[model samples]
Target: MGYETAKDLTAGTCGGIAQVLVGQPFDIVKVRMQTSPSGTYSGMLDCAGGILKNEGPLAFYKASRSSGTLTPLLGIGLCVSIQFAGLEYSKRVFSSRNVASGTGDGSLTGSQFFASGVIAGLANSVVSGPVEHIRIRLQTQPDKARLYAGPWDAFKKIYRANGIAGIYKGQVATLCREASGYGVYFWTYEKLMEREMTQKGIRRDQVNPAKTALFGAASGYTLWAVIYPIDMIKSRMQTDGFSPATGQKYKSTWDCVRTIWRAEGIKAFTRGLTPTLIRSPFANGATFLGFEMAMRVLNAA
Candidate 1:
């Protein structure tokens, strides 16, 4: 692969690791709220307190029992790596296309940035679908019930029960969420950075890492705001029970949405949103900061 591509991949990996490390505690709470029945906990604070009181402080980490490993540490890290790498790749493609077409310049327009994000999100969903499926399953499992021993065990059982399709239970919802969410994600980041650069009279390369992180956090908020409802459906579907004898709770994407709307009304779609919003700034800020730092280091080398 090209040096720039390799740099993107490595930098993305750094960002992913930072995101998961900074965000996993809030993530467990968010998943639990999203997947649990109504009244599972009063609200975000209540849910967090309950997990700490009942499940112990370590429960927030959701480590694999058998291997004593944090699942998302690797899973989400890889997902973020793919997301950033794909995003950069898509931007390069767009730039190349613009150059070939003799457009105004190779520099991406806002629309191009959004389109690049969509393509990145689509590519990311392939890995993210299954990673999130396992994560949601593990997260929503009863406190001590222990349905699956660990991430691999969960994968094995899920595969055995329903095969590859089973492992990717919420693939469709994931695709929808990722595409729309990331479109806004990159667009918001770019816009924020552009405005900052214009205001400060600095070149893109001269913009501060702290500023990049702040913009990334803003992008994260916009991403979830646009995609939270779809994400709710994806979480619910992933956590839904599948049985050979009885069938599935949510038959499809539409069915999941319909059931949620009927049973919980509009409020259900926003169940885990508080923690998500709380988590967004720190997690995504860490992500872009880490990425920017990694890229600088790589370039320096």
Candidate 2:
């Protein structure tokens, strides 16, 4: 189990980073679509087309890929905490209930998954808030034509300008996004597995590793499908703050959201849906597979 855990974590992290690099172009388009709902581009499909036409395929990916090394490591920790910690919490709660009735689903149910997701999301949000803030700033803005010189510069500028609070400008939005995204992600995956298990006439415990990976992937896709719009709003809210010189301002989260909605209408929220749909499942599967393997190895040791 310990071996499995280590192998998975190592493999998962490497795999995740690789995926990010390969798919970073799509990711950049997605981020642009999410952040600037009204700026340009007809839709996700068109957005990619424009990026390719103007900047070449390479232009599709922003600078975030090279700079995003910490993200996957963060992902490893997030998955382990969400899947394992959540599993433990759900098992304990369900086991207590089973003790009383002698009959209950030992596997975490959708409800339990939701609870566990919330816990994991909350924890991840805190850790990721600052990093994500800087990442978005870097990705959306250009390198030569930039605000802060680099990541370090971005941090220092925000700190000097707005203080520590500036670094965490959109923390609430980040928290809202993670909680919503992860909660839906885990809950949907567990529910899908339960359904698949019932249809196959197999116990939940009988589910295998490949199936588990697919289940995680399915859940991840479902989450992005449901929440992409809100994610667009959240990303824009977090990324649009201006430098001290420009003195530009965003009214509030709701205000930013409303402004986008008023200018762009409903379709704006779905701009990044295409690439994200492609990425979320694969990334999510890697995360779950990695964490599960890591825990297995750890337990054996």
Which candidate achieves the best TM-score against the true structure?
A: 1
TM-score of candidate 1 against the unseen true structure = 0.95
Per-candidate TM equals 0.95, 0.76
lDDT of each: 0.87, 0.65
**Candidate 1 lDDT tens digits, 10-54:** 999899989988888998889888888899889999999998998
Question: What stretches of model 2 exceed 4 Å from their correct place?
Answer: 1-23, 37-39, 49-109, 194-206, 242-249
Error of 1 at 154 (Å): 0.6
| Model 2: per-residue Cα lDDT over 119-206, one tens digit each | 6667666656776677678777754467755577778888887898778877777788778877887677668777878898986556
